[model samples]
Target: MTESHPHPLFAHGTLLDPQVQAALFGRTVPTTPASLTGHTAGPLEIADGSRNLRREFGGTVEGAVLHLTERELAAADAHAGDDFARRRVLLGSGEPAWAHLDARPLRPAARIVIVGDSIAYGRCDPQGGWAAHLAAAHIASNETGHRVFNLAIPGSTLADVAAQTPPLLAPRHPDTLVVAAGINDSAELLAAPDTTRDNLSHLADRLTPLAATALRHNARMVVVGPAWLDETRLDDYEGLRFTTARALALRAALRAWCEDNHIDFIDLWEPLRDRPHLFVDGVHPTPDGHKELFRHLST
Candidate 1:
């Protein structure tokens, strides 16, 4: 028989407030006093003056253990806001529960680290970009209460994502690792069918371990295929677009890999294929287009 873990959450913060708990998960979850070892909970005397749990050697702090369903855990994650970070931890009694601790020092919130290029970076928006909008909306909607850490270097490529993302994520261990790059690898010199296919497979191989790790922690892994390009405005000026066939082939490869590995795949190509107005410069999306992408993404 498989060793079963408890369906409980360790609350060390505002979720302990009865009114807050009732509002978020519909009812105050039942709780029992508990403690976590090797850590210290704090009001920390800082910005917002909220509590933080600082890890210390051979230390322990008291909290409460509450029974929560997966649905309730997700709701609680949403309610915690960006200030807290949730992680799997073992209680003092050796039971594992998701712990919501202050992440203000090291993180803005539970993380959704997006690895991608200019399109995802929202190149046209003088404002932060699509990633910022997406992050903000995701937080606002109370989905997972996670913030997007967009590592969308303007000129990044699929090869770059494969090379850079995993090592970065291996340490931070975000709840979601969104690979939002593909078009770059399907760029000028690398746009061959064989090359696109190989790059897709290679990228998947690189992301596999990180995805596995996230899954083991009850996290999600996502792959967003390249967006559709405006055919009429194709140009040589700071570009990352391809012919329709090349774009579709790349999308197919990416979608195939995600299906094979059971990773959540967001297909931007098909939805935006005929929507040329969404593109501001044949490549990057306008803010409106970015909004559309956000709609497709969060759902």
Candidate 2:
């Protein structure tokens, strides 16, 4: 029997492409009529101060586990290349599940928690993002031997992270807690400096409490500070100039706190602040920008 005519196979991520899969494995695997059980995809929310995802309103976000054929497996391996390290996990029913992961292992046994905004969620790139890049780095190195759960939601605030963290961290018992915020706060601060200051002050207050809770559970906490803005356009909003300036001050303040609190600081501002092309607008980072940040984090 030919390899392509073997049992059914399941492909995920970029491997989902038949041509790509074929290119990798040097053969094609036929799809089977089989279906994965326990495959309900509802909005997955945890109490980890993790941000919320933009779920389909009134719809269930279902996920599936596919069964891959030998030929398909070969193809997947080829497509995955060396960067994507693969793993086979045993499901509850003793079924084998293949996961094409990155080369580095941030924490193998320890559960690592990542709480942030859209950047953590890989907003633009499906295969590339700082979080994903970080995960790949971890898997490749096996340094900490931890698995990462990135709880980044688009349009989320630090308050949202505070609200949802407890539950998310409860189940995982994560050893490391990483937080990323600031961009949203900056824009909000730009809108109203006084109000933004008050808001951020409240956010700062929440951090101590959040950090205490995390530490009580023996989790190490880290904060990724906000990046710097292109203040050359400050004249565009005379009313907001003061606010923007204040926001810059707040970034410094946040850094001071991180230094004092022993939180990890992943600042994206200095690396790409003046580089206008790095930003999609006055906010989010471009793909190259994200890659640069990932490289910075890795280093």
Candidate 3:
């Protein structure tokens, strides 16, 4: 009976966008033809110069009616950010619903903002990284809203990403941020077992921007920890602690932090645990490795 929320909702803008709906509600809300009158539908400009929708007094705007719970409505409010506000309005069904009006623009459906190292930027793998595979898969699916931008630098540290990327990404207001750090940190920053844990914890506060943005949008922060590297390439790693032992320890520490902070953490170790051949240079994943990574992501 969907009784959690006694009120329904009126969607006219991004809420009506299939991808947006899926993102906010975890699935698209069932809607029927309905609308609001006494308001002209105006295009609202996003910070990125894209257009969402706004209602101005003049004409009728055709939209849909969504029966949602109070919890669901709250989720919508957060997802819309301060740029969008909800006003109580009457649905065509004669039921009360929240009408989300745009005060700003949002990322178009399907644009995935990925922040990571060369892996995200498609290092040794010429086919691009797992994120690219993800974007492509989504584009071909019913979820055609998946476009990806890899903001990964070749030799970035957790500290580097923390200091540089957030401000640039703040205006975009990403819903989910995929972070694949720890390799640079582990290799260049770690010396001992305890040192590995210490280094990871030190970068915790630097990661606040991604966490803050996600919270602001009722979104998610996903951390993709270091993958299993081939121990045979020890010398190729410049004698850094890309050692299998160090990588495993760093992975454990990162996972613990995510859990403590209530963030989602993806461990590449188990998925590629048995498939050592998936690595092209004992560090980065091959196209096949990326596909396996994509499989985990899809799940």
Candidate 4:
């Protein structure tokens, strides 16, 4: 006889926001409102690089798992848009269980971790997101002790990770480190051209060192490429063309750097180029976008 499987979800980032839930899933009916509890909420921090003030920090954050019907999930996905991150089924109690997440066979007890910025954190939308999906896809029944921890911050930059790598790598000693940056770099680059350039250069230089840190700890490093930007916020009244060109150039260069550094690169821009609605506000990936990322990673 086969065991029964409960719908599993792992919610993190802005998906923890009630308002986002309303936006993505629509107002839940009183009877259908899924009660969420047991998890403590707080401010999520980024250990590296620069930060966007208005776009970053200071918000109530929590984690949860939602058990919803396929129809509800479809409606939610439609609202989330295609560019948003993906979601997957998982144990709501944060405990490992037998289930196939993103098509991956996760054993009942495997340990996994995902690291990145606000996008990785699932900024808007309810129900834990793409990370959950990725966990689902990668988890295998034979791989017990499987767990996924998302360490994404809204305004974290490469500099943050560079500075805090040791401590970040020390505690849990994650099996995988997913580094997603560049937006904060975009904002900061415009703020101080020379300073930002030097800072980012320093960050690039430290990539090898940082990877070494992860390698010493026996962790595989996956560098997630930043998404393409049609919108650019610049300084000194710079035209959009210059900002766009520069940002794109940076993206290309960063991708190159990642390849040269031997880090697994998740190229998000290519698949999402035509999808603009997946962006929440010109920046920050929608739940749909993040879900796509999870799917991409799984593939």
lDDT per model, in order?
Answer: 0.66, 0.55, 0.64, 0.49
* lDDT string, candidate 2, 74-138, tens digits: 55556556544344322223344444433332322245678888777777666657788887766
Q: Which is better, 3 or 4, measured by TM-score?
A: 3
Candidates in order, TM-scores: namely 0.57, 0.55, 0.58, 0.54
* Tens-digit lDDT track of model 4 for 217-271: 4445566776755464223333212245555655776778765654555676765
Question: Model 4 RMSD to the real structure?
Answer: 18.6
Better of 1 and 2 by lDDT: 1
Instruction: Provide the global lDDT of candidate 3 against the true structure.
Output: 0.64
Best by TM-score: 3
* lDDT tens digits by residue: candidate 1, 177-215: 677787766665434425333454466665666565555
State the weakest 10-residue window (summed lDDT) of model 4: 48-57
Query: Candidate 1's C-alpha lDDT?
Result: 0.66
> Which has the greatest lDDT?
1
Candidate 1 wrongly placed segments (more than 4 Å): 1-110, 142-145, 170-173, 190-201, 209-218, 235-241
Candidate 3 structure quality by residue, lDDT tens digits, 6-79: 45667665567777767777776777778665344556643322245432322366777776666777786676
Which ranges of candidate 4 are over 4 A from the true structure?
1-110, 139-143, 188-198, 232-243
Give the lDDT of residue 109 in candidate 3: 27
